[model samples]
Target: MEPDEVDFAHTDAADRKRREKATELARFAWDRAISGAELLELPDDRLRKLARAAGANPPSTRETWTVVADLLDQKSAWAAANPDHPQASPAHADEKIMWVKRPIPPWT
Candidate 1:
């Protein structure tokens, strides 16, 4: 299938959302790896061990690096297209929400 074609494999909305989130995280990881993050700079053997611990199949060094490069390219293109936009920060489960109390509701 062409890269532009829709992927029917992820037809479910939740699955698509999960895949999008995973891609974002992967891009962030790649950014850290290229920005002198010691953990991300670990050798291939160590990285493979870490992947195994996370219950993920370890990719070859070439494949991993290639993906990082592709993600970086995609990010760069997005930044170019939206020069004023800021990239979103990762969401936290413990984040707090503020509620506003109005004297009257709009319906009234």
Candidate 2:
């Protein structure tokens, strides 16, 4: 294989693992939010502690969970209010997430 291809292949597993971990953490945070425990209400230190308790290894900070909680809350609230909506659940919208990515500035 070419050098670039080999490099990408090696990195692919790590990337996938990272994505999985992020999603898992997000899910945990989402559940907590839905249960009336808003993840964003915690400070960064508290979030990291909670994430560790939730099995996130190194633990994501509140800032990271804040973003996840926000998106999850939006989806959750909408789904609760509009039970008949086509895209009403995370399971139904997982594939659609890819299409929502916007180009980020290089600095970001």
Q: Candidates' TM-scores?
A: 0.34, 0.43
Compute the lDDT of residue 103 as modeled in candidate 2. 44
State residue 36's C-alpha deviation in candidate 2, in Å. 14
Model 1, residue 90: displacement in angstroms?
A: 9.7
Off by over 4 Å in 2: 1-10, 34-42, 59-108
Q: Whose TM-score is greatest here? A: 2
lDDT of the structure predicted as candidate 1? 0.46
Q: Which candidate number has the best lDDT?
A: 2
**Could you tell me the C-alpha RMSD of candidate 1 in Å?**
17.9
lDDT for 91 in candidate 1 is 29
What lDDT does candidate 1 reach at residue 45? 77
